[model samples]
Target: MSENNSSQDSRSRIARRVFPDGVDPDPRFTLANERTFLSWIRTALAFIGGGIAVEAFTSEIFGSGLRATLSIVLMVIGFILAAGAAVRWHRIESAMRRKTSLPLPLIIPIVSLASALGAGLLVLVFAGLL
Candidate 1:
């Protein structure tokens, strides 16, 4: 086989191994799931970026300990978010392939609460309350 065909075959094999139980889903649903996954990845990156920015720019606004803690918290949250996104994507794809009702989006409320609290902390810090 050509190199491209070989690569494609490898991907297909891996995909089949990873998604062994499900039949091929509708193309549109699959694409939408991918988009949702990408958006979660983007949110993860944003959190990581916030961590980097905090560590780089907060020397004057925050004391050393608080600064490091906030940065670590943001980055750790980012990692968790990324991991959760992968698992969620897999679960969602499996549900669709199984033709079952969609799973409840358990991540939504958790992410919303985290984002709100994080933003609130930033607001307090900037307002000289922290």
Candidate 2:
């Protein structure tokens, strides 16, 4: 009985967070929110994995400083993406529950700029101009 009560309480808390106006949203919308969150998580994992692989396997190709810098940058981007995803997930869920427009995703611009810079750095490194 206690376990069931606790679980119910937990769910109620989540519902309140997601639906502050006490209106339950459609189940399909909630599932879509979950899918978006999972996609972001996969993206974050890929960024982190790419960083680790570059650092571990490309030591011979890049100078120590360049390799380390690229590795750190990729890891930092991954962390940022992960944190941003969580915030976006919550905001989207809340907006969906409230029947409001979804918030614009901020990750696209950030990732694009970062990728451009990373590519530039890689070119410089490879051309021995770094």
TM-score per prediction, in order, is: 0.85, 0.82
Local distance difference test scores for all models:
0.86, 0.81
lDDT of 2 by residue, 1-130 (tens): 3666556654666665555553456989878888988898888888899889889999889878878888888988988989988888888878876788889999878878888998898788778898
Where model 2 places Cα greater than 4 Å from the true spot, the runs are 1-10, 17-19
How many clashes in each structure?
A: 0, 0
Candidate 1 global lDDT: 0.86
Q: Cα RMSD (Å) between model 1 and the true structure?
A: 5.2
- Residue ranges of candidate 1 with Cα displaced over 4 Å: 1-11
Per-residue lDDT of candidate 1, residues 31-58 (tens digit):
9999999999999999899999999998
TM-score of model 2 (CA atoms)? 0.82
**What lDDT does model 2 reach?**
0.81
